[model samples]
Target chain A: MATTSEIQSNRDLFERVARRRRRQHAEQTVFTWLLRAAVLISILTTVGIVIILVSQSVGFFAEVSPWEFLTGTEWAPLFSPQKFGVLSLVGGTLLVAVIAGLVSLTLGLGSAIFLSEYAPERLRRVLKPILEVLAGIPTVVYGYFALTFVTPILQNIFGHDQVIVFNALSAGLVMGLMIMPMVSTLSEDAMVAVPRSLRDAAYALGATRFEVSTKVVIPAALSGIVASFILGVSRAIGETMIVKIAAGATPNLTLNPLESIQAMTAYIVQVSLGETPQGSLEYKTIFAVGLLLFVMTLAMNIVGRWVISRFRQQYE
Target chain B: MNKQESIINKRQKLHAIRVLRDRIFVVGFALAVVVGILGLAALLFDVLIDGLPFLNINFLSSYASRKAENSGILAPLAGTIWIVGMTALLTIPIGVGTAIYLEEFASKNRFNRLIELNIANLAGVPSVIYGLLGLAVFVQFLFNGSRSVTAGALTMTLLILPIVVIASQEAMKAVPSSYRDAAYAMGANRWQVVKAVVLPQALPGMMSGIILALSRAIGESAPILIISSLVWVTFIPTSPDSKFTVLPLQIFTWVSQPQHSFRGIAAAAIIVLLIVLLSMNGIAIWIRSKYQSRPDQ
Candidate 1:
């Protein structure tokens, strides 16, 4: 047979090309829609999650009065009267967060200072990766470490070896250690962002290196440092495994870290992890507790954003 | 003569005080550094001593029974794998897609800003809230409607979505504008620019993020708990709809048990989890270094 080139002219080629173009165009349109759908769905899922929590939590709040939810000490939702004050849970969460926050701040800030200002470059390089390892130690491992190892230490230290079997102090301390990496990393970045010119200026003014860091760099990176602290706090509040395993199941309102107390997260796990029947009042209690946590976290996020914005404005 | 002698004495005293202060500052800083390094060293040593001894084949094959138990982590290990696998499947697509939209498709505006704020806010939300969300949504609203493996995985996907989005977006932003310009100048459409030009460049970055997030999900217990994922499974979950266990939960159960053998198993589980987490971070960092060293677009 003759070659196709000989049989087909420019007119045939034009027609074929046009058809192919239409096909490609149609395919492109489909893909665009699909991509958009995926993006929309992700956003929707995030919003949908919030909506689900809010909706179910509203159902929970309608039953338990706001005052009861906020200030009530009793939390026996499965009891005859079903009293549901969440002070104990909140108190437990605060107890843990405070301990974790304090530990992370000191360790993280100190580590940050070492990396940013003091250590030689080689040492800093070595220390940074090791520090990151400390951070990335799975939270589960932290929980176990707290329960098996740290709790024993706490017991020994407090002269309570026989007492405080399931204490918040152990859980909180380990949680703090786990979050130290987050705090240090963020704070390190902020300190690194501080211009060298500022340090030189401080030195030129006869200020000590320590003075430069605390007075100049720290103040300059105030927002970043504060942001790290807030992030660490959020982490402590959200942390579950350590508290759930080490802190025990008792949700009593107390500031003492030596006692067994149930955090909001622990309660959610306790109720959901086969302790309570599905769809029962005991189960609904998790949603109620969750709502309070959600609100607190949400408020924190708003304030964090405001702080970040204020920093940006000042810097710019 | 009196004024001159007084001035000299005052200057010497001030200099001495300055030297003392510097000495104090150095010592204080030195102490902080030592304490921080020592703290991390102590924790790692403790975990290693407890865990390294029990990392045996039997430990990998057995399941929990009772206190000071003969149990190992076979069920939980398999469950962790399933959860991480499903989570990767759910999270990577959603996270990468979100990043693409924000970085390439959508322009900066109030709507986009709101989306940005929402995402940041979501990141700050407690992981347990995500658990509740997952519980209400994945466990109840969809699938088999229980605390099945699928619910736990999907819930973790939600838990990690924000971090993934942020990481992926950073990766996308690292790509040069020249790639986009060349594609557009060649008459390539927006979708083509993204699919062909942008995504290929961004693939490694996005993969790194997914790996990190998956590693995190594997160790996560709260959301799994809220989703009602099982704790004491004797058998491996062969299906997403089946009840599952995970490394974190296993470690938790073992630690909580009032038995020495169980604590040993928990330590071993932690060691395994740490290895997995570290390996993921290593890969991401290696890829990042490679990308950075290439310098030229």
Candidate 2:
């Protein structure tokens, strides 16, 4: 039954198919490696950021003690008799962030509640995209608005003598407005995810609309809402351009919202804008401050993400 | 009978109070929505009032001058184009590839989980921190202190990489598993199945996402400002290595001027920037709407 030529031809066919499969396997491996390399780039970016920040900060700390940098009440790295107390900068950053947090949380949660529970379907459809547009406007534009428009309005309200043109209130308020949509959208998504059956159960218990929304939906979505607020505050803390433009450059330790104060981000921008030579103490100050800023944001983000994941498991 | 009447009266009062509370909430929440709408309206109106008069062809074509009247956005506009274009070219391939690796090829292992977590963290990192990273790594280390367009684009690519990867992964995930199964069952290899089935289905989504990411890049200025601080750029960027200034930076520069005239031009630049962003968003929305209703799906 096995002729010699026929057997040879069968062998040739098998070899050809095997070769093609082998080639394809090789190609697949190559492609996968290429993609893996791409993934490595992102990993490298994080590593690179950490390394650069740490290394430059090492140079900075070699000259200035970490204790003085953290607990000292003044931040005048650019002036004569350089004081590296970072608390003043931290104070300014927190003051603005706190003001922004209050505004965004109130407006953002209110809007989210309205969008999820109160607005008609048609109105919600129109309103959500409009709200999202607020998030997309450049922060620089917000900076401009804060400086030119909002500052004058603040002056009108509080009197020109009380409200300096570069007061923290204007910057904080506009920055709050900038981040409000982020909270609204995320909170709305969480609210919308709350089961309809829960709302119906509340209705069956003779709960009013307000009762149902506050007692049922909001409670169900509370963790997600809190996560959104934390992330919003994180955003407010890291915001630069608006504060750089509207908030004054003086790194005051005072809690007064009407005074000129410099945020941490604004301080970095100020140093960068000036001709601080590379590899100098002044230049290294930005990285040290950046490292601090990064750590703060990273902590909040991790907590926010953890909260979201923990609560998300409930519905899932 | 008197006690029953009093109970009934109390029930009616409770219901009335609940109704009033509901009404109050509705009005209050409606006002919150109004605040968002009114804020956007006010911003647009303010910018238009200050900017519309200055938006002319001459303003678009001229370079910056000491006099605000003669200053133009020619250099910065061209620079923005160069930066955005180069950023797209660099980001798309790497971003898409990373998504494919994580979503398609990678096993559900610790490394992949770490990658995902890292990306999430990166997304939360402030834009300014990224600027510091860019200034140190790209401008100083890679480019040897040259604030070139490539440096800026590379920085922007890294800035938006997390967004693009997340988006592309979402797009790829949206592709029906049945398509991949059919292709695989037909003796197509993994790469072949992905190329012929998944990519075609995910292309439109990925495109729209990438467009939106690019729009974000266009609006971002902090990293660019850090990378290239040359504000009074007169010549258009002719190469990847040319020093550049972007529209946001130019607007910032103008707005910082002590003179009132510069503020007018800054508003004009803002209008141009907003129009560009709106058009990009329109295209993204159009792509999403057009391709979302496929016959096969």
Candidate 3:
């Protein structure tokens, strides 16, 4: 029923709208793909790290047998008769990690409980960020503190003859301090998540505040607390600078916290700092050690995440 | 009568013990908080005492020298700025894009789930291991063993990528869903909805996250140390490919020196690094609080 001119104008307008719609569709498609490529890059990084560690480690294991590398108690890859025994380094790593574990668990859990149960809201609000600053301090600075400050304090206490200048005690203690905030924050989050109903019920039963916190809130958040501790220990195991600068480089297979010892990460730094060439076996040892360190930490992280996720599923 | 009196006495004793234990625990917990704050205060005080004498304008302007007294942080300071700048440039786009895809566009599937898990795991990996990855991939394979600033930046980009993605994702998730629904109802396309509704609302949060992540990159030294290992760099990095040294690495070098004077210089460098880091953190915290307290939020 329309006139020819009117019909022709209508057709033109319809075509223009269609074209614009097509253009928009095209833009959406392009952006989706572009963003997808970014996601792929992240996946590629993990792949690249694994491939690099494994390939370089292959070169290392080609010359040094896995059994000897695993079983040997001495780790002197830079010196003559280069011992491939990784246990010595592992021992040092575990010794420091264990000491760090004790310190962090006590201090971190103690602070978490205080923040969650004891401190008034006003005090807690101010204290939490200040506490988080501890974690924000660089590990290198912690190393310096360990060397110049904590070492002197330890030397004075343990006697200069007993605690060597580069003993594991100071390094372990400071490393514990470094990781404390992580445990405190994560555990505090979990404890905070405990329902008010639970605390109220405990109070209704005439429990003290400390009793309520320890028996109710802590148990309720135990999985998350445990996970934080595991993650903290994993961090301690992989820590490099504190051990590298404060703990001695000698790979001693001893549990004594007062003696000098070399950690796996420290040894890797030692080699990297030296004039080791790219293709040499000394250069390759770092990769091999890195693979071990990666595996250990990755396993702990997985366990930690698994535990926390399980806890989350229960509540959420 | 005797048994009832004994029971009453026992109940009173138990109550007294519980009250005593509660008071003791309060003191103990308060001490824990004190120790944490004291540790930070002591570290700052120690650095101030040792480094203050050397923290003059001359220390900021001069270059590293063989003599401890003549040494300064000019080269490393410039290098830190360059590396952190490049890292931010490379990281923001990729990290935000990935976060958007996962949060908004991607279908919930096994592959996407794996990507999420992978990112979380990567977050837990040690900084030193990232140094190894950088040494192998960027430094050796990509750059052909050239320890350039670009290579260091790329390595850092990967190292901090997980953190940025996670933070950005959290920011995106914090955006309320009603905003998206309204846009869609108004005949907006997916990308249009994101551009018009989501991004503007999420920008402040993302800014805060990015600032915090970049602060981390600034303080990080292990990856840079492995990537360059050229501590005696007396000149500022003039280009991306110029061999560079960062403040942390310079501090590490000075700390390792046998001479006692180097410790003071190292402490001076630490003071500089701490000031930069603390200010960045303050800005991020400010942004976060500002955004959180908005009327709309």
- Runs in model 1 deviating more than 4 A are A1-8, A11-21, A79-81, A161-163, A313-316, B30-33, B67-69
Candidate 2 residue-wise lDDT, A239-279, digit = tens: 98999889989999988999999999989888888899998
Question: Which segments of model 2 are wrong by more than 4 Å?
Answer: A1-13, A313-316, B294-297
For model 1, what is the C-alpha lDDT against the true structure? 0.79
lDDT of each: 0.79, 0.92, 0.92
lDDT (Cα, tens digit) per residue for candidate 1, span A1-316:
7787866876688989889878877877887676566567557766776687677777777777778788998777766887787898899889999999998888788778767987889988887787677766777777777777888888887887544978889988888878888888888888888888888999998877677878888888888888888878887887888888888888888877899998888888877766666566577677777777887877776776577567842432
TM-score of chain A of each: 0.91, 0.95, 0.97
* Cα DockQ of the candidate 3 complex: 0.81
Measured against the true two-chain complex, the DockQ scores of the candidates, in the order shown, are 0.58, 0.80, 0.81
Q: Model 3: residues >4 Å from true position, as ranges?
A: A311-316
- Per-residue alpha-carbon lDDT of model 2 for B1-297, expressed as tens digits? 999999999999999999999999988888888887898898999899999998999999999999988889999999999999999999999999999989888899998999999998998899998899889988888889999999999999999999999999999999989989998999998888877888888999999999999999999988888999888999999999999999999999998888888999999999999999988988998899899898887
Model 1 residue B74 CA deviation (Å) reads 1.5
**What's the distance in Å from true for residue B139, model 2?**
1.4
lDDT per residue (tens digit) for residues B1-297 in model 1: 999999999988987887787678666755655666676677667888987888888878888777444668888889888888888888888888788888887889999878877777777778878888777777777864667888888788878988898889988998899999999999887778888999999888887877777777877777776675566789989888888878887777777677576777678788888788888889987887776656576
Q: Model 3, range B1-297, lDDT digits (tens) per residue?
A: 999999999999999999999999999988888888898898999899999998898899999999988988999999999999999999999999999999999899998999999999999899999999999998888899899999999999998899999999999998999999999998889999888889899998899999988988988888888998897888988999899999999999999998889999999999999999999999999999988877775
